[model samples]
Target: MNTSPRILVVEDDRTVRTVVNDYLSGQGFSVTAVDNGSEVLARFAAERPALVVLDRMLPGLSGDEVCRALRATSDVPIIMLTALDAVPDRIAGLESGADDYLAKPFALKELKLRIEALLRRSRQAGAAPSEFGLGPFRVDPARRHIRRDGVPIPLTTREYELFLYLLNNPGRTISRDEILREVWQWQFGDPSTVTVHIRRLREKIEEDPRFPVHLKTEWGSGYRFDLRGGEG
Candidate 1:
């Protein structure tokens, strides 16, 4: 069913583009190469690549603009590539919807590693669940729907993915690093993003988001979903 990961590479530099394309292709990914933001949306619609390698500076649509546009319509995993090394720039990229970021002049090996890690995380986060029961919440992964005692609950794409991850690994203390790696497709992430999303999910799924019983924080460790409340 074409399970191999698909990647879209958007870069204007011919040398970097060729290198990345060749390297990723060697790693057995179906790759679609493009040079500017003008063609990104069209190709994305046609190919629907599982992940994207987006350069921050593009000819037509700047990487930030492209990322914003794509996020409005899709939640495809994006790894932003940029030469800007400022902390604010990196934070801006993440805030703008990049799943990960890599500074330019990056080692090919490191880039490949990051791509592989992101792909793995994407697959795990999106893993289909026949049905998952967490306390009173029941989720159908295939349909991306959730219900509490038969009452439907609405969730955004990111919230749904985070909920599924917690449900799938009930009772396991998931570190921020683990959550970012598994759900966000990034080795490192802005911790605020994790906290913000968790808060949002708690609001939707928990009977009382203020004192969440299902999703609990573990002091300095991380967060976990305690289905049995550790009493059974």
Candidate 2:
């Protein structure tokens, strides 16, 4: 039998942690639970989970901080859990490198769906090739490495997958719903999550993230990956 997918849960709340852990395990996942941001990196290195459920408010290291730090080294998928409902707060989480987000007091079913969606995307992206180039960035999918102007730029697993998706479909506008389905494998659409990942991708790949030349926003639509160096 195949080993269950490993999941790392980084939340300070005991009740929330237990609920997620128990629920995911019952769904046939292997879970490692940890509290505080301080331990996330170490646990991640050791556990090498297939995905991470990280809380936005963490002791020692904030969820965003942890996500950013992890992005600097690895491409592990991270889904942030937070109580903040503000748009800015959601953006902040995405900008900090989270792959997806879930507001607190969320339904367990929703969380399960998100986890499964992320995992499916990861698996699909991994099974494909290891080399892709778009704009100024080049990615070796087999090695899971990305470089800009020949200088290595590290990306987490989710970031790499997002980048790959954009590269594979340049110039065409991809709706948030499509991104959710293709990148997150979410049948139930989540535009907020798509927005966050796109924002984070811009920060990593664009020389000027505030005015990106590659990842272009489509105003009322979603986003387009401009590979020809032209503004959308």
Candidate 3:
């Protein structure tokens, strides 16, 4: 029985793809490498990999497009690789359904570490049967699903992790640095990543994102998630 976790690598660059595939395989993962974006969905459907390492530029359907398509039906973690190193480009990748992003010329060791972290989190979330309530919302961690007032609330993989982290530690202010370290499992990275995810969470959880109540920013500190919202 080959029980090793499967990883799908999507990169147009042959050298990068081959290197990543070999590296991940050496790291004890079962890797499937693809060169074109168009093949991503088919491979995903067939393999149902534990994670996907996708390049932003590809021969067919761009990375963003493939990401969006995958997100429509699955919450499998995606790490986007791109040549664009600007803050906005990273943010755009996250917005396009990537759970994490790495720029071109990245260290292979860091990529491996991130893959381990995401896979660990995914396994933990799935194996644990945690059901809880936050105000009107119901969280089922085992299923990676949440609902409010009988309606399902859609959340990206990162958003769900962030929400659950806050819910588990209620009332205490969680610093963005702590969030990056804990939720993202990154010792250092753009704080804006946390900011972007928090904003997206507020939109889905708050009655009015413009004046959020449950997920409150502590100005110079960080954020706190509450069960009840203040009066509008």
Candidate 4:
């Protein structure tokens, strides 16, 4: 019985796809490689991959469209690959539901490390069973779920991690660097990653994202979560 984690690699570039597939396979992952976005959902449904490596640009459907479609029904971790390394481009990828983003000219080792980290988190989330509440929010650790005012809020893996981290800390101001290190497990990377995730979390939980009550920014310091302010 081969229980290696399955991985779906969606890249239009032939060379890149082949290299990634070979590398991941060599690293003991069961890789299903595809050439376009159109095949992503079918493959995903069929393979039920542990993670997806998606290209930002595709011949049809577009990577973002495919990502959004997958996110509609699954919290599966997704890592977006793109040549566009601009802040806005990365932000767009993250906004479209990618749990992580890598520039086209990226290291394969880094990709493997990311995939391992996500899988590890997924497993840990499943193994833990704890039900906790703070104000309007409730966390179901076993289900990897969080609800606001009795309504479930859909969050990607990364978003959920960030939310729980902040919720656990309560009112302490946390810097972007600290968030990146703790939540993302990255000592060095774009700070925008944390910023975008925070924005997304606010949009989902806050009555008004622009005037967030629970997840508040502490000026130049960072962000603070206030359970009392958000409590009814």
Candidate 2 structure quality by residue, lDDT tens digits, 68-164: 8887777778888989978889888888878778888899898888788777766764676857676677877667677887988676667777777
Error of 2 at 145 (Å): 4.3
**Runs with alpha carbons beyond 4 Å of true place in candidate 4:** 230-232
Worst 10 residues of 4 by lDDT: 223-232
Give the C-alpha miss distance for residue 62 in model 3, angstroms.
Answer: 1.4
Best-performing candidate as measured by TM-score: 4
Candidate 3: the clashing residue pairs are none
Which lDDT tens digits does candidate 3 get at residues 1-232? 9999999999999899999999889989999999999899999999999999999888779999999999999989999999999999888888788889889999999999888888888877757776878777799888788887768888877888988888888788899999998899878989988988888788888889999888899999999877766532
Q: Write down the lDDT of every candidate, Cα atoms only.
A: 0.80, 0.83, 0.88, 0.92
Any residue pairs clashing in model 2, and if so which? 75-156, 75-157, 130-141, 130-142
TM-score of each: 0.67, 0.81, 0.91, 0.96
Q: Lowest summed-lDDT stretch of 10 residues in model 3? A: 223-232
For model 4 the TM-score comes to 0.96
Which regions in candidate 2 have their CA more than 4 angstroms from the true location?
Answer: 130-139, 144-152, 187-190
Give the worst 10-residue stretch by lDDT in candidate 2: 121-130
| After superposition, candidate 1 runs with Cα above 4 Å error | 1-4, 124-128, 135-137, 142-232
lDDT-sorted candidate list, best first: 4, 3, 2, 1
What is the clash count of model 1? 0
User: What is the overall TM-score of model 1 with all chains considered together?
Assistant: 0.67
Worst 10 residues of 1 by lDDT: 117-126
